[model samples]
Target: MRRRPSKEQFEQQIEQTAKALHDEMIAGKWAAGSFLPPEKSLEARFGLSNYSIRLGLEQLVQEGWIEKIAGVGNRVVATRPQVKLTIACENVTLRNLKTSGAGRTISAFYPWIQVEFLSMISPIPGTDLSERTLAGDLVLLDNVQFQQLSENRLTHLLEPLSEDDEWYPQFTKHFSVEGRRLLQPIVLSPLVLCYNKAHFRESGLAEPNGSWTWNDLIRHAELLYDGRGRYGFAFHIQSLYRWPLFLIQSRERFEESGEEFLRSRSSRLLDGLKLCKDILHNRKAVPLYLSENNDDINRMFMEGKLSMTLNTYMGLNSWNEAEIEYDISPVPYMDSPRTLLITLGAGINGSSEHKEEARLLVDFLGRCGRERESAYADRIRHYCKCCAQRLP
Candidate 1:
């Protein structure tokens, strides 16, 4: 004596069957583009009515796992959609990073999800984000980009993650909004003066130190400059990381005066700009083409064609790998020793359909290898030492 199931019970059965199918698909039981079993077979296997089988396949269809052909059977679309993570990085490819510490963490924790990186990034203008412009499921944003995201109300894309003991307070604060974390800091790099030791020794000039001022730097650069192919010092004058020190010095000076803050900003910025312009135009200490890129500067430094350059921890991995003999000191400034703190963090896209999965990836990356004994910790330590940052 068999009893037919109620409509609600049938629907529940459909949901369960759909979930099972989804799990199997993720487990690679069915290859992508392969057709599912016939409707009659599905009905017989699940012991469900024809309607229930249709409903279950429809569920899979909605989840992007399968595509329904009008007259044909259901075909697999994708077992898992690869999450796209956008990075505004230079000189490195996504393939190179995917097998690193964070990449291994993601792979171990999320065996089913794949990650892809898109690096070309353009600034979002006027505090507005068009979905067309933001083309990734997750984005690695810098401080400036974070400010833009905050202004444009796009930070809602970031999932709020549970803070762990491994996170450094100073680094975490950089990505926090109104006490809420918008992203998790994965990298911390401070601006520093990376000078070629051999060049200073060859020029018979004192190497740069914390006490050195901008004037001192310029003077040493002039002394080191050879009238031939070699340059004394090099850096991008328009860089936010290097140029802001001048503004900070100006602000300190104006703090003791009666000038308004905005007025101070304009005047101080111009003063900073004038200083940089003079270094290029009048002093002729820097080459006109030094602004080409850090690649050119790094190449020249490695080749012993440049004396000093302003850089951050981001340059350490390459420099160390190249075995370039060099040392670092705090960047020279006018009023006090100042450097910009650069942070790299990861955030999820709010509109992503797979938000829960994205959150898992973000969370794992934030705490992957911060422990003392961990292999990831060893890697982090190596990178930190290269950058001369204090380990937490």
Candidate 2:
């Protein structure tokens, strides 16, 4: 015995089908001014009868999303869905973005799409990241948090990057979780050794090279130590950004549990910490008051009180502004050349109603290569690095 849907049930099914198609149209599945598939194809696609398909199309026609002709198929009337993409970010990050001209750039890129930037404050204090993304169309997360979003299924797994999508492999790997790419990297900030040229020249020490090891760096740092207010090496003592480089350089993965990592190379970790302490306290190679504040370190470096420090590309902005004579080099390593990469990226919220618009905004922010310079993306292209392969 088989049961067929009643008239009311059939009509409900048609309404549901209509809503699905309408959402698809709103999602930019098909271009506007183009005809929808034939009724037979629609029947197969939605697993509904031909009458249901017609009813669904008629429903959409009433919604102004499509129009049916006498003999032809249903024509799409609206291509771009009217959606305001809401980007959630921290206050400082938002300020930096505004200062960097992100808003004007995105507006020029997608004139039809509306964008809204929201300061992401927890509903309650310390609600954490998962709760934050649930309310946003797009979210800005650092590399570690971005991976958490993908691992926890909080982000929409984006489509595969095309051949033309330009990104550095080194940076891209930091954002990839499992098998899918969920985050669109917007900034490139990597940990590096920032050296003061004057310090090296005064000490008669040659500039650091890739071949330099941790021992060589320590030696050079000791040589440059003037035993006065000046220091050979200095870095934020309690900084996550700088400490992780020690673990990475030692060919160890970061473990939330210190027990596991310590069992193998407890001495190495101890040695690393001891080295920093000796430089700061015993050797007096670093200013004693120097702690975990980057701004203070940046100020000290700018004042020519420190020789070398571990920093990122962002540090350059301050140094460049101060016109400090500094050059960057790869961080010295113990076993392997490793540097901690810090990046900020955007990912679409899985349950967002404005996925298409959110995607467009993220893509615009992350776009690279030559074509982007010619498109609306050109407005923000100043933030990106241009090369001979791409046109200005």
Candidate 3:
């Protein structure tokens, strides 16, 4: 008699089956919203038992590759697309905040406040959170202009802000002064640097060894670029924070001794800028600044045209969706390894009559993970619970 499949073997079989089904869905062999083949038939096709087939389909469903109806077979609800949750706040540690008794009681007692995904401005596609307020729901809110939280409010505010031109100034100004006391902020995940490991190996370049410095990265780019059609690197201008990180790593600060604007006398800062300019101009490492119309740096990287780029954890989903082989590593560092940290926080609206209740909900949403944290994290790489201590 044939021996039973080992647990590892069964897992491999399930993964292979899921990939085949996914490929079929992608090729239009199975139309979207159409029911997938029955478990028995798939079992026969893959030469597995019905139990194994169900296991594979369950895996697919969890990965958001398909959905199961109450009476209908599994249907291709949607293809998992890459989603990013950009959060902004003041505090920099990834730890949980302690709430007082008044805060907990307020949240537990509120009835009108509900937590739900707001579809109007949600960053992910097809994922809806339109409900007013629900526990463990991800909501996106910007800074309330000309508004202040009450001193006795005891509320948490979660703000996910991107480092955009318009928002960064407001965020810096808001958090530098007002946010320090009122809000607690933490980066949910480390900044992720992803590159095509296969491409690097094929081009006779070493796979980035987990950590690298600015000079090390430059050398690798120089060696990888050969005046050929292939380019050494490509990055979105929006991710220009990497430039400042280089300065920070070199023990240089952006602010002057007593001024708010960035300092100009730091020779190290000037050197880093000159290096970037050289890479852009002389080395021809990166393409000339393309107009917004044709500026899909992620797409270019996915097409296997570039060797490396600096991207956030959320960008990993995009690479996965594009089916390009890649690996994640910490962002390049300088003298001492460091990443420019960004975080989101929850706060109460001072004007709302439900201010007390809102504070409770904010604390629960920001700190509670029993229900919503995993689901959000699975959908978006950056939507992590503040207290999740696992290092990645």
Residue-level lDDT of model 1, residues 1-392, one tens digit each, is 89988878877899899977876775557888899899999888999879889989988888788999888999988455554444333223232233355555666655556665555334321223444445666666656557666777766666666665577676676677878887777656567788888888877888888788888988888888888867778876655556665655544344544566566656765686577667776345677674655567778788877788877665566665655578988777666455566666777766676665666666666654243225445434433332322211
| Highest TM-score against the true fold, candidate | 2
Better candidate number, 1 or 3, judged by TM-score: 1
Tens-digit per-residue lDDT, 1-392, candidate 3: 98989999989998899878966764457766788988778888999988888888998889786888977789987444322221212111111122233234433443223332222332321122232221222222222211222222323443322232322232334333343433322223345566788778877778775457756776777666667656777565433334444554455445545553445555676665665666566355666656241127667777777777776542343344567788766666545456543334344433344333344455445444223334444533332112221211
Candidate 2 residue lDDT tens string, 121-219: 643211355664446677776665655555676545443332224765545665565656767777655667889998898778899876677778778
TM-score of each: 0.64, 0.65, 0.48
Q: Order of all candidates by TM-score, from best down to worst?
A: 2, 1, 3
When 1 and 2 are scored with TM-score, the better candidate is 2
Clash pairs for candidate 2: none
Off by over 4 Å in 3: 1-180, 184-187, 226-228, 238-240, 256-266, 282-284, 291-295, 368-392
